[model samples]
Target chain A: MSGPATHVRGKKTLARSILGFVDKGLVNAVLVIVAIFWLVPTLGLFLSSLRTVGDSASSGWWTVFTTPAQLTIENYASLLSNPTITGSFWNTILIAVPTTVFVVIFGALAGYAFAWLKFPGRDWLLIVVIVLLAVPLQVALIPLARMFGTLGIFGSIFGVILFHVAFGLPFAIFLLRNFFTQIPAELLEAARIDGASDWRIFVQVILPLGGPAIASLAIFQFLWTWNDMLVALIFTNSGSQPLTVAIQSQLRQFGSNIDVLSAGAFLSMIVPLIVFFAFQRFFVQALLAGSQK
Target chain B: MTQLVAPVANSPAGGDKRRPPHGSSRRRMFMIALGFLAPALVFLGALVLYPIVYTVVRSFFSAGGGEFVGWDNYVTMFTNDSTFTAIRNNVLWVLVAPAACTILGLIFAVLLEKIKWATAFKLIIFMPMAISMLAAGVIFRGMFQENPNLGVVNAALVTVNSAFGQDAAYPGAAGRDGLGLVQDRGVIASESTVESGSEQNFPLVGIRVDSVPAAAAQAEPAVNARAGQLVGTVWLDVVRGGGGTSGQIDDGKTGLPGILVDAVAADGTIAASATTDAAGRYVIDGLAEGAYRVALPAANFDEGYQGVSWLSSTFITGVIILSYIWIWAGFSMVMISSGLSAIDRSLQEAARMDGANEWNVFTRITAPLLSPVLIVVFVTLIINVLKIFDLVYVIPPGSAKPAANVIAVEMWTVSFGGGNNQGLGSALAILLLILVLPSMIINIRRFREERQQ
Candidate 1:
């Protein structure tokens, strides 16, 4: 056989061998493992949340099967009913919603600026921001708290909201900017030639087409703000602790009542998961889309 | 979101000033830009910027408030005190964890995602990812427990040990439980009035585990005490020369020294501790049946720091960088793979027909086409790493043995860990937000640019 034919045949054989291996069911087995990896903790968290305090600590949640009827809803009932938890849950919602909304709105705008706007110090500002991204969160906490004290906003919902907004803006901007930047210049140019105002153009042309990007950005910001413990712990007072702080504060010095924590942990994750799966289709593609650029 | 509308501002401002019937439109555009941006900028400036300025000022002043010390705290931190140690340990963490995690993450993302069990692999790695830093610390602390660390890491080690047919050398005979033992016995006799007597009365004591059958019978497991591994037990004993209290050693094998006061309080606490023997040996066993930490005193510590938190603002920064690389690499790979897939098949066929080699076509055509996505990925990752707190915080913060501390974790620790000084903690926090703000703006701007494109 000629060299090209030989090489082509070799390549085809390799491909065929790979396909044959997949056809033999290795791929399916792997998928099951993947499903288990993702599902187990979720299942563990779910099962653990429902289990008795003793069961959760002494053994894995899988052992719940020994007495199939042993599953209890008491944890959930208690979680919802617990006065502290109830307040915190509501507080989390309050903190999370506004923080997420603002961050996304701000992020989208900043992203657009980086992508399309010609302004003084754009490159320098970009460099500065890149450098800023590396600053540790620890360095900022104390000063921010002091600032809050001066503003009389410390230990309140406002303080926490402000903190989340500040922190969340960067990531949202980072991801959204990449997504917005990739929109073909021709599209915006077309709108410009048509005399579409920038705001009109953004709202009409960019925002609509940027749906997938926005969805992902919103989801991330939502999860981040909702799950954030440090800012909430510092910025809010007794009346308005978010779930993470509330749950963490409940930690008894030696060992806490693991059951409540189990319940609380799972509950906290609920929104993110729901939000994630709710937008799972958008996420699957966009997870790497903006990230690549 | 106003930033999202920035481009709209561009058209009516200097960029498109000559547009017909645009006198009111220009005013409307400026109003829109201000309207869109005003709220966020207000919130950010009030919450983030002002605080950072306070920290920069605070860092130079004394706690009691005096004159501008001009980087005195910075100087003191670098020149003296345990803060230096914290910096060192943090540096090591920055160097090690992030780079490793990111590289591992990238590899895992690429390989594991392709596996039939891709989700499972993702879940396993991401399992740690999802857990809060405090929770992960608790879990890891358990996993890396000090005596027989009963966590997963130690269990694996024990399994490995069993496979090799090894055991702790001897029972607790390595040291007296709480009693003191002399370390050296000089040449001169106790009653000697010789010129060298002052240096001669050094106490020398040794445990005869072999001679004491019972002592050897209850020997604990001796195991590795590698840095940050977290589980193992050790003990040490000291016998006094003249019925005098020298120093009571606890852990008998090889481990760092921490006080284990033998004098039990009236409450009758066991106060079981493991202090290393003269050879710096301590063996801690029965560690709740899992992984544990065993450490030896450092001969000399080399300084490394993980940088201050929010963004990894240090020369020794590591974890953040690694994670950024990992996520970005994976992201780029995904995009590139897609881009590769999207390449016009007809073009490749055309190239083949023209007798161009595959490598030549790929270099000339594929790479250039892939550039946009790659740039987006790298820049976004740099920004993402700046904003990230989750992965770094999960590690915990400490500088002695590379405290798994991240800036975010530090913020949580200070704000909640109940310190005597809230002012300092707040200062640190304000600094964190300030540091992140500029980047936040950069990211948003990048987003706007992207959107406009």
Candidate 2:
């Protein structure tokens, strides 16, 4: 008893020392540096947008302390009020939120079948879906854009959303299917025996249980659409442009108002951060069966 | 793709085992599969399979129905030497950026998990990742704008140069005397890419430089005067061709080194100049070219951060690594976290009761069982990395010339960027697909395997 206890005690102390070092300095320092690394550029952008063209050229935003004190929030104020960027923000919302919703709903339904259904070619269908996930987005873009243009949806927000949903479905389905398989089959069989229809079974039995998968999938789709610059650029024009495209227009191959950009970027990010935090409980990707089986 | 059969409770060979379902159970399963999977299949075939097949067929025949080249594009990609360099560069990018970004992301994730403010810290690090590379490129391009000390990087360099490195000599000295030196302010439309950001600053032009006393410059006046001079301030625009030849400075056609005054400042506040002497050259004697600058009083070099607003480009030397890491790691972390959470807690408690420390519990008791998740994460992330474009597309190359464009970028540029050369773009893209598909297939197989387990 003494020998084992002492061995455990020694190991615990070693673990403690390692944890102590990490907690005391190394980890905190890394996190702080990483956070700052990302933050400074963003802040620089904010400062740049606010400063006059001359001031931006003459000095960095960080150097504002030594310079003539002429800081202003005009960049943000101006950009937020602009018709193009402002409108695009709404367009982005329309595209992102709906795409997220569609992908989750469809992916969950499809995943449920793949997990529980015993149909002809069930295994083949899943394999085909996985292979579909391998398709590069670029290879599909031009052709899809052409198809969309032909269908009269290319220039519209709907086209972009549809494209995102279509692409997002495969991976989303894959994730949900994987998650669905881990759930015990007895629960589903019990619900079925108790006379639940397929839809009822999905909604009452599986939906609540599938929160984490849905949330993460939603997060993925939302971010993809929100930050989507490529499809939007190709399919949509000036009026339908998203924040990324709008911001790209502001850059004059020579110099740009950085402060406005930083402020604008921050503004663009606000919703995602909120969504991420709001969904933090679901953020724990494996709370199924108490997360630990 | 290898077909993964159903997750039978036990191997069919091992007794009747948990017995594969029969009768009504089998029929209900077929109904479920048909109902749930059809929507996903239709979309996949329509969007993904159609285009890939189209590209493969289209690449074989040329734009105007040229004879089937049958691997000609692939041949050119490898044999055309320049294209090979591009492939090499692409390989370099794949090697450096993905690994660095993943490592950094994992490191940051692990580190940040400890902080009370971990969420806040993660937001900050991952924040850059969230910002479209397009925005990032622009911001960096501006900072790298090369007016001697005008660019942020140059300004920092100037501060450091003044603080550490020497201020350059005055502009009076003969040009091309031995070494021709001049300092001129550079311009950047994008932010400065801090590749070599930890640079010393050069002193502001017209200040310390003017004090070099024109007499030292006068030491070679006859020699300098004989050298061709810019009677008025001149702008030398380097175009794509005019591939330079080595020669002594000649008037008009050659040699800004041909001039006594290499350049008059754009503002005219400083007549600071370089003198080029006999071997047909003039050296701007005193100049601080240490940082935040494009030394236009010279040639062949522009600021490293010239972002291409044309066709949408930003030249960030560092952001490539930064962006790749954050995104990939963020995804990997989700997998890691979820995988760990999936393990039964009793096992953890059992280790605890047995006196296993947290480390031992995690490593010995945990990681072994977590192999499924690790495999899933590794395979998925690798697949994601293989076809990465959106993030790369956002970051325009940060140089006058990009170090290398991602295959996706190459595809877009080749296809629609003016030349209307769909064949080449399609070919490059097809090649990219060939490279990525095997791993992707392997990943799917693994995913199916884990699901079965």
Candidate 3:
């Protein structure tokens, strides 16, 4: 009986090892392939941006590796030299930053109220906000544009910012409300017993505790406003147009200027990539929180 | 300590002894809550609620919002061919793009589980999510360009084709008008019959100078034709500049190489066919001594692999949809991956221990558990794709824009993109709102379910 048991154990170990090896091999193979598939298009764009216009037009981007001397920063330089492109870059910053700051502040305040503070009609109001989450931005564009026009803020960065802030509130309020609800009610009560006013408790306790949620909200709002084209397209005139609108206009129909396109596209992509990587963990956590209640 | 004291502090006797009475305190708290909620509510009312109401109202008016039209714009929208096309394309988008993204994301997420570098893989895949839709549109537009030298996708396709010994014939080639060949549909055929042993000359035009192959030699008239053979020359009639005669092969003209020329019998059947060489010369040998029409088959004049015509009316929506998938698939993957990670590994193991195979374990355990997340992702994507505007607006060229329009884009076009019909645009906006509401309800319900769980 001992001899048969020993033989069985040896056979089981061999099978387990083989299984582990195959699993690892299959996982790695799939990971690598998917990674390549995701990376190649961006890789093509990046490599094309690095090459001169003539070189890019004459040969494939893959050929840049074979002829190392063909790479150039001329496209980037030329794009930077253009006044409109540079102006639109600043315009994007002007719109995104203010929108992010305002949305976070208002969203957090509203979220705190809905979570802890009790008021008449609070539940109904919260429900209203929740339903507003589904309102397609398209439904608002024409009416809002007309309103902005009447208000004389149309074709301005402020108009765009206002539109963004308004549209951004529902999601921000929803996310932060859910996040704020998880805070222990006891903590706020204790603060209340310590003679802190409601505002004091909110400012002193809730704000600090809500860092992750706020960061997530800020990142999301910033990215949306910065990368936005439709809002900026309708609201901002020629002077206040964001980088997205600028890049889009540069796309000529008859013959595309590839040099401007590749460089401008890279320029537009870089800032969001920076923000995404910088706060990637927070973003992921927010996504989980947002999706999983 | 705090827990024991907390209840006592919150007890009515203790709290009443230290604080204001319930009525005034409630009023003050309500005011404070009002203060906090006012800004968001005001913004929501002024921006969202008011606009929505106004859109519904204005939709009934005329283009300038001056006259009440009473559903006329809605009638116009539903009846308009372009608007119908937009609706059809949008339906296609909602059906295909989201499903493709969700499935790809699911595959990626599930496969990511056993990998050591899962974080890195997820980041790379999610990278496109950071790119603005405009940039993505640009990238895809360039990537799908018809010109091989310009578009990366076609460049790769051309390389693969050439590697496999298949090559494209001249795209955009045509028969010169008033020449011996008559152009019909896409085919260029002989206007008159030629007897065997006669040399027929076919002059082609409209091939771009740069598109002409480097191996193309100067046009040469067909050499002496044998008694049993038919011969022809297919050469570019136009010169680089503007000085060439219309129907004659002029000096400095180049041969339209690789053109397929055929000899047709009286019954329209192709009796013989020959492909042109570098000198634009083809000789159909072993033809019977009879009258035959020297013709260029439609395949010769048919547009060669111009790499998909991505910006054309036929494929513009597809190109835009591709771009959307590229940007959002990463987002779906990350969302679903987090859900996937929260799944119970013990359940999977238990199924495995019960002698379930990998596929069964996945199908029975993993998929059912992940269905909620999948539904949420799908619903969110549907909501998103329904209103997709930027890629559709930015990717297609001017000629194809009408074909690739979505409801959101058509709304903009009518209101702003030169249509200037505010009533129609408002009606379109309301229609979009109605369409998106169902998906939004589903998504909200899913969110509530997830929260309950």
Per-residue lDDT tens digits for candidate 2, residues B1-453, read 012234444233211122256787667655665666667667767777787787787677664446677777767667754446446656765666555654454445444545678656644554444445555555555554555434555566556655653333233222121222333343111122111112111111222233332322211112321122222221121111444222212122222223233233334343344433322233333333322221333221222232223322233434454546644555555445555556787786777668776579767877788766555555555555656555555444334234445666666656754546566667777877787787667766765664566
TM-score of chain B of each: 0.46, 0.54, 0.72
In order of appearance, the predictions have TM-scores of 0.60, 0.69, 0.81
User: Residue-wise lDDT of candidate 1 within B187-225, one digit each (tens)?
Assistant: 111221212101111122343333222222222333544
Q: Which stretches in model 1 have alpha-carbon errors above 4 Å?
A: A1-7, A10-47, A56-71, A108-140, A170-206, A252-256, A284-292, B1-32, B64-66, B79-82, B112-453
Instruction: Select the stronger candidate by DockQ from 1 and 3.
Output: 3
Which has the better lDDT: candidate 2, or candidate 3? 3
TM-score of 2: 0.69
Docking class for model 3 is acceptable
Question: What CA RMSD would you report for each candidate?
Answer: 14.7, 13.4, 6.5
Best by DockQ: 3
Q: How far in Å is the alpha carbon of B165 misplaced in model 2? A: 3.8
The DockQ scores of all candidates, in the order shown, are: 0.19, 0.28, 0.43
Top candidate, metric lDDT: 3
lDDT of 3 by residue, A99-184 (tens): 99999999999998887777778767877887788788988898888788899999999999999999999989989988887766
Q: Write the per-residue lDDT of candidate 2 for residues A104-145, one digit (tens) a residue.
A: 888999988776655667677777777777666777765776
Chain B of candidate 1 achieves a TM-score of 0.46
TM-score for chain A, prediction 3: 0.94
Best by TM-score: 3
Local accuracy of candidate 1 as per-residue lDDT tens digits, A15-86 = 645654664365456545544543443455567678777655555455566766769998999889899999
